[model samples]
Target: MRIIILFLFFIAVGVGAFSQTPKKKVGADNRAVPTKNKIQSQMNEATSGIAKEIADLEEQLKTETDEETIKNLKEQIGMLKKQLKMMQGLNKNVSNMSNKVIQQAFNSETSEIPKRDVNRINSLPKKILNDGELFVFMKQTTQEVENKLAIEGKKLGMQLFDTLKARKYSAQAMGQYAFACMAGGFPEMGLYIYGKACLADMNNADNLNNYAAYLTMAGGEQYSIPILDNLNSKYPFNSTILNNLGQAWFGLGDMNKAKKNLEDAVRIYSIHSRANETLCLIQQSEGQTQQATES
Candidate 1:
């Protein structure tokens, strides 16, 4: 009895917090949100239909018992059950998505961030970073379609840039936007976004490190000379930075430098997975495979 009372109290507090918390906006760049009730109704209807079909099949199976017919009816019943469960889950997900969209809309209307300008995507001025509204609006949509819309990655990146530009442009925004573009499956566009981000703020160590890391991963030796010098200069002996620097040299076929940098990084952060992996790689390249073998 006491435990139940405590649970009820906790639930009441949770409800109060949610009721007081303000909602977020979907952004000036909105996606279509299906109504929760409609989705739920569809879910119920689908479930009913499937249940009715299964009942009919069961009834038929009882009367007409050919061995092969019974087997097929059992299989169909199993398939229909799975479909019904899936539809119900989808309906619940739809309702959740609707709430998120609605909250985002509310937050946007209350916040000072400018709405995204859906007009021209390519010609956005560099002054867009002054406002913080664009990412707020477009990030969700970009995530929603990016992997599925890999072919349209360039278009999405361009659109995102212009949307962000309508707010303000900064290394932070550019870096994040570029990274997002890359994540969305447009490697080249991601590189371009990183370029814009780096150009906007050369003093940003993280931006340089990450952008170079991306280049190192993509172009291997071809990109070593480009970002290594700058990264090494900026972050002297930082562990993760050193690890990446080691990787950059490794890609450029400088096995000695790779081994050296990776060793230094491991010395600083002994348990770093990537540093260990890099060390293992270096060992393999030097025919020290047995020594580097994972236990």
Candidate 2:
């Protein structure tokens, strides 16, 4: 009887130990969560692939080929070179990490962001010294505005506005700062920045599109329409551009035109959040009117 009791106790202890053990969470690839090492490994693998492609393209160039095909291959090689540079830019500290690991870190700190400081805003430079300063300042202010801290977004936006006016910066940077203004609840300033960005870089499709959309929002539909039309003509199949054009039409109270562009946006990218939200708003408004008439 004593032996039997001891055996039973051992069995119960074993079961409890098993229950306390942690399980490995398998992701879609049926593996444990990725680590920095995994990210580094993936980057290395991509680098190897790019190198292989470059070699193969060189071989193709050596072979007899048509002029057009040769030009395309050269362009592809150039693109691969750019990718190689970008891959090499990965920091040594994070070189070993996987995207999942980075994402996890980002998620952990998402809510720990500090609030905006009014004193800092009040004493900020009247004009950013350079594009790099502009970028860093915008990054610092982005979280503040997004968190909706005590500081007014307009104040930060005005600083960007002044910076653009007082100093020279890249067109891309100008467009980005302008977007910050728009998000900070200063649509007028955003439009001005967008205009400057577009003027500086007419070939910048992004700035042109954003400027047109802001113009529409600011009740400059007549000015924005032509620009949107020109973009549509240029990028007939780009979903984001189409969505912006639709938004411009919506601002003009042209439901039919808005629906057409918005529909095209959905067809191009089913998961487009902005296009879906606009469609829902239109539907809800029409539904409410119909219900009111019925009552």
Candidate 3:
């Protein structure tokens, strides 16, 4: 699934005509700061658990007489082994780096998006708007307006921008605005707005997930990986997060890691279309015709 998963930001417009604006570097002052020791400990424990599970499954395979059961056990063991390897690699990487170094690396990677300018908005006190309100506003303003040529559309865009700067919108609202910008043919602005949204609310899982997705779509998979990894640590069973992480690894040409995460995602949620499709593609690429067809 190399296609962009525009979950709710689908807009019928010619996005190709517009040249992407130069990215403005933004600081990572509000990013979800990871604790090196804690994450390492968690990964170590998870690796141990996976290793033990693999051992148990291998033992079961040894004693099982039913061919079907044996096949399932072997498959489980193989998946577990891959997971073990991934965890060990992650632990090694995390253990070798200091928290400051990790943070610096992340900041450097995500410096393309522009920082929010607090001074652009009005100074008067106003009620903070939510995502729903912002979305309605976006819909109303974008109706029948072509941002690139139409004067009305340009005015609307400025109105939207000014409104965003006018007050400290909620994180969810910022996320919505980011989507609107992207769907409405403003990729650079969308990225910038979403970057600030992620910074403002790093704890929100949806916010982080969407941000990573945007980065991956924009050929910034290297930057998305860290965020996806952190999100994975917090929500190990989230299929969407695992799928996104797998896509990022695939984008970086790490087939093993990509396969591992995609497999985990599909195993957790068999109905995940993107994960299943990607896994199938990997199998086809490797000449595993039977496996690919089955997938």
| Top lDDT prediction, candidate number | 3
Lowest lDDT block of 10, candidate 3: 9-18
lDDT of 2 at 235: 56
| Model 2 C-alpha lDDT per residue in residues 178-228, reported as the tens digit of each score | 643343334444555566566666656566656655554444554555665
Q: Higher-TM-score candidate among 2 and 3?
A: 3
Better structure of 1 and 2 per TM-score? 1
Looking at model 2, the pairs that clash are 36-96, 36-97, 37-96, 39-97
How well is each residue in 77-148 modelled by candidate 1, as lDDT tens digits?
Answer: 664465456555544555565645533432232112222223321222323221133333223323432443
Quick one: ranking by lDDT, best first? 3, 2, 1
Give the candidate number with the greatest TM-score.
3
What would the TM-scores of all predictions be? 0.45, 0.41, 0.48
Candidate 3's C-alpha runs over 4 A off are 1-162
| lDDT at 126, model 3 | 40
Candidate 1: worst-modelled 10 consecutive residues by lDDT = 7-16
Question: What's the lDDT for residue 44 in model 2?
Answer: 63
TM-score-better candidate, 1 vs 3: 3
